[model samples]
Each structure stands twice: as structure tokens, then as C-alpha cells.
Target: MSEFKQLSRSVQGLSVLVTGAASGMGRATARVFADEGAHVAVTDVSADGAKLVADEIGASGATARAWALDVGDASAIDRVVGEVAAHFGGLDIIVNNAGISVRVAIDDPAYEDAWARGIAVMLTAHPRIIRAALPYLRKSPCPRIVNIASTEALGATALHSPYSAAKGGVTSLTRSLAVELGREGITVNCICPGPIRTAITERIPEEHKIIYAKRRTALGRYGDPEEVAHMTLSLCLPAASFLTGAVIPVDGGLMARNA
Candidate 1:
């Protein structure tokens, strides 16, 4: 294998499927997996962006493919999982990284939509992806699932209660899935990212941006999406066979101190 392919194939020859793979953490994680020797399928709601990521992976000499999906739809998740598995022979890793941000104040009627949409994408849809991938993942010698969560789930953040609540559900699901799948050789874990400098955080108002940049944040600034992605890959790799049900926070120590 070429150097790029050598780095891309961790767990020997397993396949990984990452949702929201068009950009940010999803795109970064997909690249990391490709470097580690795994054939990676990148999925996103953005068809063009997904195609771009697939192209980048393929250029590196890794097997790559793309699918545009609306994760909230169970049938869509099922169809995509099947497609990725069919492309790569089977599924061994899944990263539930796609999520929508909801920002609404008390007086805003949009709060209701934000709450509902946030939950649908962040919490409800993840298990549906796992359910669809389970049969194939179970067949792998090393099966793993990584759910992208948020530090908001652990601590109170003004104006983001709904988003935090949705991530809290993700945190819970990680533990539950781990216990259920551990016997079958699948490990499940979560990454609680701090306010990462994704498009979502870039849009935050300058005034309140500091609310997420308090002394509690040891890193002193918002984390880059790839930084969070690197943390994610560590947990999802097949060499991490002994780790499961872990909630590893990539928050720059935001959760280590009292607010």
C-alpha cells in the first residue's frame, strides 16, 4: 500500500461511514480514516460537497464514495448504510457527526422549530443509522460507533438549552448502545466538542461570543473542526477495541471547572 493508503487503513481492512461528511468534523474524520487505510463513504445533505470529499479521498488512493442523505429520515439512513456497505463489502465503523444548530431566544417562535429540528438531527436519527448498520458492523472483527455530542450537554449555556438537551440524548444513547453492542464486539463512544470554529460558531454574535470563551476554556479560543475530528478518530479506530461507552470531551477543558 502507498503511504497515504497505509495510514488510511486502520483495523486492517474495515470500512467506515461518516454522516455530515461534506464539511467540518465529518469531512475531517473521513479524511483521517482514509489516511489510516479504511475505505470511507462520506454522506451529507449536500450532494456537491459530499462529492467533493469523495473526490479528495479518491485522489489519495483510498476507496471513496458519497451519498446525499437527510438523516432524520429512517429509510434514508437505512438505504445509505446499505449502499456504503455494498460499496466496501461491509461496514465496521460509523461516525454519527451530522447535526443542525438551533439558536432561538425565549420570545422567538422559532424556538419550537429549533428544538424539534435539533432533536431530530442530533439525537433521534443516530440510532436509526446504527440500527441499519448493525448487521454488517456485527460481522466485522472490530466494530465501532462514535456519536458527536457537545459540551453544552454537560453544562448550562445561555440561549442553547434545546441544543444541549438534544446532545444530552446523544450522550445517553452512546452509553446504552455500548452496553448492548459490547458483547457483539462493537464499541460505542461519544465526543463532546466545545464551541468549535465551524460555520455554526462563526455566525455567533460578537457580543455573546465571549460567553463561550470564558477562563473555563483552557485552550483560550474556539477549537478547529479538524482538532475535534482528530479526537474523534482516536476513539473510533479499531485499535481502540478495549474502549467503549466513553464520553470523551474535546472541549479544551471547558468542562473541567465550574461556570
Candidate 2:
């Protein structure tokens, strides 16, 4: 029999950075990784919220730390990424899950501002974070970058041009970087979450949410944040080495439905 080679499916002892981890999918992602034995950096613009998540993870006997990070601030991004790498001693994976809702007509006076902020947080921050973490990530056995896009990147909704544009950019960036970093064994992937319950969607009327899910999703129900988080985790596994540049939709089959 040929010798069997071993590959790792675990992320234990790996250092992972999850942006916008105070609430929603980001928070769920952090918890999932911590549960799996990875050292999680729960960062968000909301310092208290970030601390709360880290505290919760610590209380669960998992490894985690909180950092006040505003993804839109370039200087802060550099500083925080450096601090996270320094504090953790090494960084392996980055989940760019920070995002904002920017709903405005192209003709609106605030359209430009909305577009700039949305792009800065959702699209631009991905590259900045990746670049900053490259030194550490390059030194790790498994270097993974997961950029959290949205189904809006594939299908757009009215009044969400900025959000859609940024997400689209993220998907593109993921593909381009995956190709560019392939030779180095670094995996870059994008996830487009369809209709997950998050802080952004909290204000939607429950009846409307149900109606939309029934009409638009194959599963006829909204997905949970952990569902998406698990997908993120799967891509970061060292055994997933062959998979890269893939844009996955964790929307309960929303993208599979057509009416």
C-alpha cells in the first residue's frame, strides 16, 4: 500500500482575525472559531461590543481577545492589524466581515458619501487587512483569507447600489487575489450571504422577512449566522488547500431560486 499522507482538518492553535465581530455573523464566526480551538481576535468599531464577545468566548474557556477597530480607518487598520499580530505572535486567517448598509438613490445628495463609506468598510478594508497580515500569514502553514461579500454581489436590490458595488468588488478581489496568491499556497475565497438574521436585517418586519424568504429562497427560510460561519471555517481548514478562488453563497439556496 502506498503511504498515506496526513492533512489537517483542524484550526486549533491558529490565530484568526474576525472584523465586525461584535454582533451578527461576525460574532457568530468568532464564537465558531473559538469553539474549534483557534485564537480569535474579535474586533469591531464598537469597543464594548467587541470586549463582550471576547469575554463570552473566554468565559467559555476558549481563546479570544477584543480590539477596537474601525475598518474604515486606514491608520487604525494598520495599527490594529499590527497589534493583533503582535499580541497573538502570529496570524493565519482573516475574515473580513465588517460591513454597513448604504441605501440611497444614485441621484440622492448623500449618494457619494454613502458609496465612499460603504466601499471603504466593505471593499477597501479587505485588501488593507490582507496586506497588513501578509507578513504573518505568509509564515503560517495555512494562510486563508475569507472576504464576506453578499448575494447582492450576484443579484442587486433597489436603493442598495453602494452595498452591491462594494460586495461586487470584494468578490472580484477574492478571485484576483486567489489567483495571485495561489503559487504561495494561500487561499482567498468569498462568501455571499443571502438572507441571514443579522443586526442589519433586524429592523425588517417579521412578516415581510417570511414572505421574502418564501418567495425568493429555495429553502423557504432564512439561514442562521452559524451556518455561514461554519462555511467560513470549512474554507480555512488546512485540508481545504486545493479549494481557492471560489465564491460561495450561504444564503439557504437563495441564489438557486428563480421566480
Candidate 3:
């Protein structure tokens, strides 16, 4: 077989599970994978949103299904993963992209609950989902895992301590799991996005957006969700088989500013 053909086969007809696939980066990532001919399992806390995306994919003649998945719930994670894997025969790729951002200051009254919830959904859920999907992932010839971290993992910003900490934990977990799963032919990596224009950031005040565009990102503007989705898709291809334990920044040269 030609080298190009071999590389193209990597993404075709594989079973992929994308968490938080209702909107933003998750929705974009799931759509990209399905467009590339993968059977996509669209999951999110919002059942209606999940069904919408899944129905959209199904309209394109691909095998897609929506499942209600609250990553913070352990039993829901296990059950949804098992059902998706069985439905697809086995799972090949898993993207832990489900996250919530709460910007409560450390001294705020609601800080405790916000902190705990952020960690539970972002940091803790990655490993739990991975564990639940391992059996099916192991059965695939090309098993891959991508954790959606953020630029906050590499640096800190005020009023987002919990989010920053959880992302940092995700980066660490990605590296550790890559090492542990290497022997199993399962590659793991994480992507740190700088500032993507999504529903999550739509609430940022215009002044803050202006400042971020001027100084924080080298690109001088926010990125599209599809930009991040493209990088995520590349990491799942056979060409990226040798790439693992990598903390790649999809952050428009933000990380490169100092490095």
C-alpha cells in the first residue's frame, strides 16, 4: 500500500468518542472526525445539544449517536462509555474535552464549590473516562487519546485558580498516561488552547477582549473552534503514531512569546 493510503486509513471508519460534544471545541472536533469518515459518539451534559449535533452528523450519512454524559458522574461515565463502545463494536479514539469555567476569586463565598466542581469535571473525569474506555481502546489497532487542556495550564491568571490548576493536572496526567499506555499501543497527548472564540468566552467583557487581543495572544485575535479541531484531528492520524506524551499548544504563539 502507498504511504498516503496507509495514513488516510488511520482516520477512516474508526470509532471515536468526544465528550462535551454539544458546542464549542467539542462540537467542532466531533464534526471534523465524522467528516473524515469516523463513527462518532457525541456526548454531553446537554442531551438536546448532543442530539442536535448527532442528528446533524447522521444527516451526512455517517454513523453518529448522541448520549447524555455528565463527566462529573462516575457511573454515567462508565455506562455511557460502555454503551458507545458496544454500539461501535469497539472504540479507537477518546477525546476528553468536557470542561466548565468558573471565575470565582479564592476569597469569594462560592469559591469552594466552584473549585471542587471544576476539578471534578476537568481533572478527575479525564482519568475516569480513560479507565472506563481502556478495554475497548485496547482492542483497536490504533488507539488514541486527546485531552483538551488550556493555556492556563502553562500560566496563571487571576480569578481562575481552580481552572488553571485543573488544566495543569490534565497536562501532567497526559504525560503520565502516555508513558503507561505506550506499551499497549495507545498514544496519549494534550492540547493547550490559548483563546478560542466560543460560547464560554462570549461572556467576557469587551474591554477584556480588547486587552487579550492586544497583548495576551501573539495572533492578536481569538481563534476559531475549527482551528483547534484541526490540530486535534491531526494528532489522531497514523502520521502522528510516533507522537505521544506531547503538550502541544494550539495557542497562536502565546507560549512561544517567552520560550
Candidate 4:
């Protein structure tokens, strides 16, 4: 009889770096990973917010550290990824969740700036980070990458061309890298969240949010950041080895409806 090869479901003791982790989905993803015993690098443009999340996790007896990172800066991506790997011994997973929301018309003067900024932070940062972390990730038995795309990648709304374009790029990047990295045992996946209750959506009026949720989502509500984070966690698991190139929707059925 052939012996069974067991795979691990736990992320305990693994090193994880989460970008834009100062608040919203990034914060939730860091916390979830820390709670499960991973050493988390909570990095964000807002240093104070990242520290707060790291401190909160430390207070709970979990492992975490904070770093100020601007994903749009290519040099910063290399520096921070290296520092996080040094601090945690090695990096096994990277969650490219940093983002900016750009809502501008195509003819608007600000549209060009919005598009450039959106692409820099969201689409471009993914490969830069993964490239920086490749050396360390290669040393690990399980290496994973999770890129946070959006439902807007699958469908779109008016006035969000820049944001949608960047997200669409992320999904494509996820697939291309998944194929390229598969031979190395590095799993790359994407999560397309829909109507998530994050800082970006917080500005919308409560009534308007509720109305939109009811009209658009199948579940009739917005999803919490932790809900999206959990899916990110699942994809990084060693047990999910065969799940590369998957563009999963953690959208509470947002993409499942047509009417």
C-alpha cells in the first residue's frame, strides 16, 4: 500500500506580510493570520495604524510587527519585504492588499493622475513584492501569494474606470503568475470582494449603502472585512496546494446575480 502524504491546514509559525494592513481588509487579514499563530508583518502607509494593529495582536500574545510601507514605491517594497523576512526569519506568504480608490470621469483632469496612482499601488505592487520575496519564499516548503482584487474586476460601475482597470489588471496578473510560479510550488490566487464594509465604503451614507446592498447583492448586505480575510487565509494554507490560479469571489453572492 502507498503511504499517505499529509498536508497542513494550520499557518502556525509561518511568516506573513500583509500590505495596507493598517485598517479595513488588510488589518483583518493580519489579525486573522496572527490569531492562528503566524508571525505577521502589518505594513501600511499609515504607520500609526499599522502599529496599532500590531500592538493589538501583541497584546493578545500573538506575534506581529508594524512597518510603514507605501506599495506604490518600488524601493519601499523591496526594503520592507527584506526587513520583514529578516525579522521573521523567512517569509512564506504575502498578501498584496494595498489599494487606493479612484473615482474620476475619463474626461476629468484628475483622471490621469487617478489612473496612474491606482495602477501603481494596486496592480504594479503585486509583482514587485512577490519578486522581492521570491528568494525567501523559495526556501519555504509552502509559499503562497494572495492578491486582493475586487468584484469590479468582473463587472464595473460608472466613474470608477481607474479603480476597475487596476483591479482587472490584478486578476490577470494573478493568473499569469500562478501559471509561471506553479512549477516552483508557489500558489498565487486572487480574491474579488464585493460590497465589503471597509474604509472605502464607510463614506457612503448608511441608507444608501443599505439600498445598494439590497439592490445589488444576493445576500442583501455588505460583508465584513474579516469574512474576506478568512478566504485569504484559506488560500495560503498548505492544504490548498492544488488551488492555484483560482480567482475566488468572497462576495456573498454579489457576482452570482443577474437581475
Clashes of each: 11, 0, 0, 0
* Candidate 1 vs. true structure, TM-score: 0.90
Candidate 3 local distance difference test against the native: 0.92
> After superposing candidate 4, which stretches have Cα over 4 Å from the reference?
1-5
1 versus 2: better lDDT goes to: 2
Q: What overall lDDT goes with each candidate model?
A: 0.85, 0.96, 0.92, 0.94
For candidate 2, what is the lDDT?
Answer: 0.96
Q: Which pairs, if any, clash in model 4? A: none
211-240, model 2: which lDDT tens digit per residue?
999999999988899999999999999999
Model 4 TM-score, all chains together: 0.98
Report the C-alpha lDDT of model 1 over 4-40, residue by residue, as the tens digit. 5332225546798999999888899898888878888
Indicate the TM-score of model 3.
Answer: 0.95
Cα lDDT tens digits, model 4, 75-120, are 9999999999999999999999999888999999888889899999
Leading candidate by lDDT = 2
lDDT of 3 by residue, 107-221 (tens): 9999999999999999999999999999998889889999999999998989999999999999999999999999988999999998888889989987898787768677877
Query: After aligning candidate 1 to the native by TM-score, how far in Å is the CA of 209 from where it should be?
Result: 5.7
What's the best-to-worst order under lDDT?
2, 4, 3, 1
- Structure candidate 2, residue pairs in collision: none
